[model samples]
Target: MQRLSENPNTLLALYRISQAASSANTPRDAYIVIIEELQRLYDPHAAAICLINPNTSLLEIDYALGYPPNLPELAIHPGKGISGRAAFNGEPILCNDVETDPRYVKLIEGVRSKIAAPMIAGGQIIGALNVDRDHVDGFTEDDLDNLVHIANEASRVLQSVWRKRQLVMQSSQLNALIEVGQSIVSKFEIQSLWQTVTEAAHQLTGAGLCTLQLYESKEKKVSLQTVFPENLEFLDMVGDIAVTESLAGSAIRTKRQVEFSNITTPDYRDLHDVPHDSEVTSCLSTPMIYEGKVIGIINVFTRERHRFANSERRLLQAFASLAAVAAQNAELYSRVFNSEERLRKSERLTTLGLLSAEIAHEIRNPLTVIKLLFSSLDLQYPESDPRNKDKQVIREKIDHLEEIVSKVLSFGKAPEGIFTHWDIDDLIADTCLLVRHKMGQLKIDLRHHASSRKARVNGNKGQLQQVLLNLIINATDAMPKGGILTITTKVEQIERRSVVALYIEDTGSGIPENLVARIFDSFLTGKAEGTGLGLSIVKRILRSHHGDISVTDTSEHGTTMRIELPFVR
Candidate 1:
């Protein structure tokens, strides 16, 4: 051993070990200097500084002078070997011959004496200072005492380094949570939200694979919603698993989290045969929940064996909760937005319908005067005269104009809702054929479906035709991007009276509930340039004919409009 020369040098060496913690620029550098000082004070054939691996809680030799060739492969749990026992109980051990002691685990091959002293800080044993010699009974009690003293000297430096590492880990976790929260809240689409959540999870945990498995309660099935960095073979095999079969599914079914520390082990990897599954060591799943109900599962995977910290699991739980809430809120907002838009549209159309009625009234007055003038003149002509034919054409034209004006003014009253024997199915077929060309250009598939015998109704053919045409046009406008339009005819009992019903179904944006109530009100229309009189007229004609119209159903998928006309007795 280096002659300490005097008690002053001995004191100086201990001081250096204590001061090295704050004096060195880095934790690694300080630890290196501390180990060197321990060896310099007590010369031994072999010496090493061991530290506890926090992840596994095992003693690992950080730096060793003489150990077995595969020393790095050795992991000593607390209280197992002489060094481990010293670390576990915070005591010092001086073995005169390690070969004679059962507690002394043989490491290096030779005649041996060993000494191990626990490194303690804040009343906790963190590791140990260990040394071995080639000669038997080489280390004395005084040497063991000196080793204990060295451990104490280095304790301050180790404590400082550990605390600093913990702080860094905490800062990273907090920042990750904040960024994820902002990303999820800003997303409105369900697919986009899933992507954000899964990608964030992969980045935060540094996992090899991350995924979202959504549970469809209606189907009682779990399916993968999102898989980040998508070429994982194990995930492909476990793509769709039943709740009773897989870890992620179990988490969803039970509304809890599940974890597997090493999935490649015989017990788990063999239970469910993951196809071509390789390289997965850890798996963790947290249920995505909102309002106390499980929606899906957030799964993370790692290639190296890993133990999930409680704080990390809690953070994932927080992320899943936020994702669920955000998705639910976006859906609710979409519905409310559609409803409000329809209500505003209805109000505007009603206002325009009132103005239209006034214009029709003024036009009717001028037409009556013209009719009287033609009658007062009493112009007569020969039957063969071409002028007589022209005069007759004028009369017919005026009468048609008169009919239109009357219909306009009596829009709600239905002044001309005359009943007649009308083949309803035939009428729909004709109208559909008329618009087939237009629908083709819009990429809409138009189909006419009829069941049972042809339905004949006691309704004005012209008026009913107008109503059907208006409904068809409105439905087409709803699907500007093109979709399926189905017209079906059937006879069914409505309140015990058999009525002929015409149903118009369109794969278009559904009507908002608020607007459905006022849909038939004059001047209310969905189209930007529509006068909104068509459905109002259709409602008037049907009501006058002892029939009615109603919306069968409407949603994001599409809308169905029903026209009911009482059958002729």
Candidate 2:
């Protein structure tokens, strides 16, 4: 230390080296100056600075001065060369004889001496700065002291630059996270949001591939939600990495980020059956947590083994948080949309009910007066008189009008039925009785068949009656030209459970092919004066009973509607 301050020329050089080190924005720049100062002060023929490459676990010459252009860049393991020894021991070494010193590994063959000092900061030897001289006994103890001082200054500068770089990188990553967060929030559609998230993750990590795996907690399995490149062959390779088998799976199970630097190693390689062409050397997988449980994983893949810096991990974690929020929001939005649609349908049904009640009310009073007049005229005449035949014709016409009016009144009236252990066969009979008048008017032959097994289903006596009645009425309407109307009841077994089926078939003009799909939709009518609610109301009643009504067959010949109900235990 005293020799370093004794020489005026060496002192000035030390001062200049300190100034250059202080002004350097990075450790590499400061290291270059320190090596140059060592050459100027000691007159070395060759100088080089080697630093550790953490990824490969090898020392590499990051910056070198005064070495031949054709000379291979220095690369050595820890504790391998004279410089590696200084780096390994964290001390300064001045070897006076190149051939005699065990620490020296000759790079340029000649009789020479060498001085090497560790570039250490925070108690870790990052690498070493070394200078070589062609003359023997060229470097002195004083020169070693000055070189150590300059190496210390260089180490300090490098540490500062490294810290500054970390802060800058962190700032950039944070800005990217903010941008991704904003993008996810702005996208309301789930598919669009997923696309944005995948794209953002790829951009942030500079990864060759990005994938999101969505887990169905109830199913205890995950599915690939989205994969970038759409056709990337690595999907099968990386996608096969199970949540129970690989590092990604471990992260998902732990609800944290799992990083693998050396994917080619036996430990990690054994976990997945990756293909050679996948070339996935490094991986960072973060869990997507929602409601305090890991719901999925977001994985990023790089082409080369990477020591995922802390900043990169943090940025990815932030992005994962945003993805979770977006997923939850998208699910909620879908639910809200579905609820709103149900409310609208309910409102429309209520409006239709009210309008039907009003129309029935207006038509009932006038029809009652006509029925009273017809009855009086029939009483004033005798059945055997010559004029009775003409009077009978008038009476029959009045009765038909009354029957039509009664049907309209029944449609508007609230259902009423005495619940009983009634056979579905009997119910079909009652429904046929109601529609028998219309069937006669249309000249349609109505055939009814019942299951010999006596199948019974639990339901509202009156509502079920109404359902059958509406279906029969619609069936008759379909056959305006008087085709056969077939009503059949049978017991069926579905999924190893017994069910009762009621089928109604008509031979009238079948529903148009285009309108057939929506025939059961409310307010969808094919007739000029049809209310269009018959099939819709039938469907509603069947659904309320935990049953289903559907069109089983339709063609130009006819349409067949079937209703299925769970068998009563």
* RMSD vs true structure, all candidates: 16.7, 19.5
Q: Write the per-residue lDDT of candidate 2 for residues 228-280, one digit (tens) a residue.
A: 64545555545533445545567777787988776767766555433345667
Candidate 1 Cα misplacement greater than 4 A, ranges: 1-14, 20-27, 54-57, 66-71, 77-80, 88-90, 109-111, 120-125, 152-156, 217-220, 232-241, 253-256, 266-278, 328-569
lDDT, candidate 1, residue 116?
92
Writing each residue's lDDT as its tens digit, candidate 1 over 1-569 gives 43334445456668887787666655676667766765676667788778887767899887776666675687889898889999988889988888789998766677388899998889888899888788888887767776777788777777876566656776787898888888787676778888888999998888888878778777666777677876555456566666656566667667888887777766665444222254677888899898888888888888777788877798888888888887775565454345435444643554455576688889889999998898788889999999899899989988998999888777723256456787888878866655655676588999999858878888777667667766777787889999999999888986778888888999999998889889888767777777776677677778888888988899989999888887765
Whole-model lDDT values for every prediction: 0.76, 0.75
Where model 2 places Cα greater than 4 Å from the true spot, the runs are 7-22, 26-28, 68-73, 108-111, 229-242, 245-247, 266-276, 379-569
Quote the lDDT for 480 in model 1.
93
TM-score of each: 0.58, 0.64
- The candidate that achieves the highest TM-score relative to the unseen native structure: 2
